[model samples]
Target: MQGHRPSQKQLYDHFAPKMLGVCYRYARTLQEAEDFLQEAFITVFRKLDQYRNEGPLGKWIYRIVINTCINGIRARCRFSDTAGRIDVEHLENESTAHPAAHSEIIELVRQLPTVYMTVFNLHAVEGYPHEDIAKMLDTNVNTVRSQYSRARTLLMKKLGSGPKTNENGKRG
Candidate 1:
């Protein structure tokens, strides 16, 4: 059965916050995320008719947000080689052990190259499979897998390990 068209207000109320959060993870600043969010919503509204109910509405909205973030990254990345380098010193040591340290992780993620950022965000943050990411980016699954591994390595290096404790309450 065909799904009914969702109104702008309805869609906005349902998706804006979560989509903006997705945008924030990839955007360098809140303003940039807002801009991407606006553009993404516009695209979603225009392409709403094309949405098949085969997937959940949240997933469709997520794809639009991811695409929007990728576009923004590509635009800025064309002239910037700086994003490819990982500056481990700039990362906080606590962020590695504490998942609640979002700001530090977000900053590190922002430093990743455009290709890596898109793949990492989709696979790690958004929880999309490598096959889906490859299809979306027009690349092979192996490429996606490699990029994800690279991104994770960079993150681990940047966010360093904390003091190690053994299984029996002994410090290592």
Candidate 2:
């Protein structure tokens, strides 16, 4: 299938669900996630030619979706920052835990502050290293590390558990 090209509808049909799952991880609301998914699919189709076929198509599309989500978050942050600042402490202190039988973990993750959530998802979910995440977010590696630490702490607190330790007795 070297010379083969899937139609846009075919690509959308195959990838939309998976890509929407990725978007939902970053977005705070379902509507926002849907918007990001639509925008990402638009970008994927526009940049389809840049995919060199050296790797699986899904990986390539996943990268694009991640970039699109990051960009959307950045843009939203910029707009919100310009308008006014949010009391992150208040938001964090609010009751975030919900008694949902399913999607409780995802709901907990969504309650995290944007920076912490982004770092946590990138590191723990996407399996990106701190150094790579630093580059991707245009911040220092130490900052990413700090954010990841805080994210883990918050998550553990919300989950009503102590932090997990590795075999070496360091925080996992």
For each candidate, what is the lDDT? 0.73, 0.76
Query: Per-residue CA lDDT of candidate 1, range 111-172, in tens?
Result: 77667777777876678899998877767788777777766666665666433447894657
Q: 44 in model 1: Cα distance from truth in Å?
A: 1.8
lDDT of 1: 0.73
lDDT tens string, model 2, 110-140? Answer: 8978877887789878999999988888888
Q: Among all windows of ten consecutive residues in candidate 1, which has the lowest summed lDDT?
A: 79-88
Please give the distance, in angstroms, between residue 74's alpha carbon in candidate 1 and its true position after superposition.
3.2
Clashing pairs in 1: none
Off by over 4 Å in 1: 1-7, 52-55, 78-99, 162-172
Per model, state how many residue pairs clash. Answer: 0, 0
TM values, all candidates: 0.67, 0.77
lDDT of model 1 at position 121: 76
Q: For residue 120, give model 1's deviation from the true position in Å.
A: 1.4
